[model samples]
Target: MDKIRIKNLELFAKHGVFPEENALGQKFLVSADLYTDIRPAGLTDDLNASIDYGMVCHKIKDFLEQHTFRLLETAAEKLAWSLLTEIAGLKKVTLEIQKPWAPVGLPLETVSVRITRGWHTVYIALGSNLGEKETYLRNAVESLNQADGCRVEEVSEFLVTEPYGYTEQDDFLNGCLCLRTLLTPEELLALLHKLEQEAERKREIRWGPRTLDLDIIFYDDLVMDSRDLQIPHGDMQNRDFVLRPLAQIAPYVRHPILKKTVGGMLADLEHSQKI
Candidate 1:
């Protein structure tokens, strides 16, 4: 990624823990690194191909002046998110919010909070075996599309698959979705669970039939293992229902742990079936 840097742009804002500090206002220094592809802009000599640092600076200043926060942490976080959301061609951002004139009696150069934030690519496997299966899946997709900080980029065609567990229930409508999101893996998982609950999903049996099922299959090549969640989902490579749809959107997405592309995994699965 190429870098566009804006350093120590000053702003006058009323952000502070103390009442006097808020009333009196103070100087806040902001610095940001915009991450994106600059090759096209350089070669084409096109301003539209890259982000304008001047415009971004003005936007940041406006956002800070428009909102009041007591903590620099809050300010930095909000600014980072806003930049990612509002600025086009911006892939990631590193932001620093500095408070140079703190009311501390001791001598200090400055107090600051810094953070890096970016968009993440995520693959989700969706299924429903209960009533109105297609409706459940469609509604789930729509719901995700409407979510904040998330964009539903592509959805694979639904496939009817036999139940994975002991239940002799109806066949499941299964598919996958590719999304770009600002939510962390854990946050995305929580949101999926919430969507399941909204669909009145029950957990009486393992892999049991349900109104809806949503699982996080991949998150930006991340490999994680925890009691509550797992990335590159534990059984994705072996599941045709998951692989088929996932391949439609991201066949070349490499698994961080397995070190195999989705297409490679699917090919391996097909070969195994022949043997």
Candidate 2:
């Protein structure tokens, strides 16, 4: 990843805890490092292929002047999100907001807030075994697409599969999807739980029947294990339903820990089941 650096671009904005500070306004310095791949632009000598620092500077200035927030943290957070969301070809950003005039009256050179934010690629598995199974799966996809800071990039064809556990239940509609989001793993998990609850999912039994079941299969080739969640989905390599749909969308996506491609895992799983 390459960077386009913008430093100490001064602007006048009204943002403060004090009433007079908001009314009178103050001088603030803003800086940013825009991360992106500039190789294409460099090779072609094309400005369009690269992010324009000049345009980004204007964007930062306009955003600061237009929005009023009491805290520098809030301003930097919102500004970073705004730039990442609006800028084309921008993958990540490190933003800083420096306030030279402090109301604290302590002899301080400057007060500043700096933060980094970026988008992440995630893969999610979707399943439903009760109440219009297909409908639940489709609605879940739509819900994820409409969620803030999330974009559904690809979806595999839903397949009807026999229940894996608690086998007495009905067959499920299962599939996988690729998502581009700004949310962290935990935040994404929370959103999934919210959607599941909306569908009236209940976890009374292990692998119990449910109106909806959402699992995080992978998060940017990341490997993590916590009490509530597991990346690479602990049992994905053993579940045909998960791998079948996932491979359809991302056959070459490698598991972070196993270092095996989704397609290879699916093939291995299928071969073992036969033997």
What range of 10 consecutive residues in model 1 has the weakest lDDT sum? 161-170
lDDT of 2 at 212: 95
Largest lDDT belongs to which candidate? 2
Model 1 per-residue lDDT tens digits across residues 16-107: 99998778889999999999999999999999998988899999999999888888889888888899988888999999888999888989
Query: Model 1, residue 134: displacement in angstroms?
Result: 1.4
Off by over 4 Å in 2: none
RMSD in angstroms between candidate 1 and the native structure over all alpha carbons: 1.1
**In candidate 1, which residue pairs get closer than 3 Å at backbone N, Cα or C atoms, i.e. clash?**
none
Q: In model 2, which residue pairs have backbone atoms overlapping below 3 Å? A: none
Report the Cα lDDT for residue 53, model 1: 89
Q: How far is candidate 2 from the true structure (C-alpha RMSD, Å)?
A: 1.4
The model with the greatest TM-score is 1
Residue lDDT tens for model 2, 202-223: 9898887999999999999788
